[model samples]
Target: MNDKHFDKIKNNDGFIAALDQSGGSTPKALAAYGVPETAYSNDDEMFKLVHDMRTRIITSPAFSSEKILGAILFEQTMDREIEGKYTGDYLADKGVVPFLKVDKGLAEKENGVQMMKPIHDLDETLRRANERHIFGTKMRSVIHEPNEEGIKAVVDQQFDIAKRIIEAGLVPIIEPEVDINSSDKEKCEDMLKEEILKHLNELSSDQLVMLKLTIPTKANLYKELIEHPNVVRVVALSGGYSRDEANEKLKENDGLIASFSRALASDLHADQSDAEFNQSLQKAVDSIHDASVNKK
Candidate 1:
């Protein structure tokens, strides 16, 4: 695992864990699974979670590999109250980077106009980045079926958002999730790609970090990006589905999947045991990996 191949993981495919609350639990979990960093969304529990994860991500057996435990922190999902100074102090001493999901989130209505509100205050986000100066973030750069104005909006926002986040010293992963639940797979494929190319074409080297693609079976074509000409980092989407659906997506490359409600929510819907649940999920990914290799 010299530095060269380690660089292949720039964003393409490798395991990424969504550690919603149990960041501390990832060291053992990742080691046992033979995966990469486990991510946590900085929410009400971040102080406890980040503290635990930052410690283990460094000491974990995989540290030499440079794949630390990571998380997706959106002010909405993580915590809106975490200010810049507080985050900076915490992350710097821990010596780990976090992926902030930078969404202004929904706007707060004021007067007759809507006031833009980021999930966590960008001021705080910048503060956190400045403190340790090595954090990562994911920004939503595009959406589905956009009209001319919509496409323009995507391109315009990337430039503005990236500029601010970079000033704060954070790595940004761009997520332009195209809707995947289309009535027909073929139409969905064409639209998905057209939308992807549009935003990608507009991205400046500094504005776009990693391209996050939706890996649901909108059509198997959606899965083709696993080999798409564009080598941006791709993350799987929920697709308004179940855990089985998400694990199925992981089949492409065990290293390139994101587990959301589908992964953890299985416990809520099924009577399966922990071991049984994992085995079933592993089996799906194994099958997908085999197929992906065979296709090549």
Candidate 2:
């Protein structure tokens, strides 16, 4: 692990940029950026277009470390180049820590939740990420309703993978996202918190992890998790919320910072002029930064 990048993540007062939209989410991301599905004919072309969009964001002057502490990249993005440098190296050079999304998307819903599909060749993937100067990894699972058995399974699966990631010399952002629109969102949050604490307590004092969760329906619901000895930092996912709504909810929870994806790119468009695009991105960065560092 890079000590400098670790220190920055531990001490920085900025939000993480969730630019890790994978194959499944890329189309929606591109459409939001004003690129239609018709623009790309095949998987290669589709990935290329998404890569171009990410490149533009990474290169933008507004997307600086001043308000963006880290960026999570899709595996492809990590392997790609930005201005002649590999994505991870470029992010580190710009003082923004780089993380890779390592999971192979979620499995079908079962027991009222969607667990991550098996990650084949995880060790090899970690080796490549480390080679590229990536600092950490993020994987996700989904919780639909407040099913105790299912939620426990989700948390168990996350922690299990997280241990492997840690052994490979990378911090893992453990995300067991409870659907925002779930009828029992608060119940799920409560149960999820309990399960997380159980696992966190089992970790050795030196073992550290990060948590990326849905912004809880109850304010300060994760206060304990944020202060847990085994936790480095706790961040909130947008979970389909608009930027404004996410920021508002984030402000209600003091220690939790933002790691938003769709919300972060909501204002950007592929056709915008350089000046307009930068301006819009700057607005997003500034708002999220404020919600992250300047608590209400």
Model 1 vs. true fold: TM: 0.53
Q: How do the residues 91-171 of candidate 1 rate in per-residue lDDT, one tens digit apiece? A: 333333345555654243322212223445666755654443335666553344434445445545554565576556555
TM-score of each: 0.53, 0.99
Using TM-score as the measure, which candidate wins? 2
> Which residue pairs come into collision in candidate 2?
none
lDDT of 2 by residue, 1-296 (tens): 78998888888899999999988889999999999999999989999999999999999999999999999999999999998999999988899999999999999999999999999889999999989989999999999989999999999999999999999999999999999999999999999999999999999987889999999999999999999988989999999999999999999998999999999999999999999999999999999999988777
Best by lDDT: 2
RMSD to native for every prediction? Answer: 9.4, 0.6
Worst 10 residues of 2 by lDDT: 3-12
Candidate 1 regions exceeding 4 Å error are 1-13, 19-69, 74-97, 107-120, 132-134, 140-148, 182-189, 195-199, 202-208, 216-232, 250-256, 259-265, 268-296
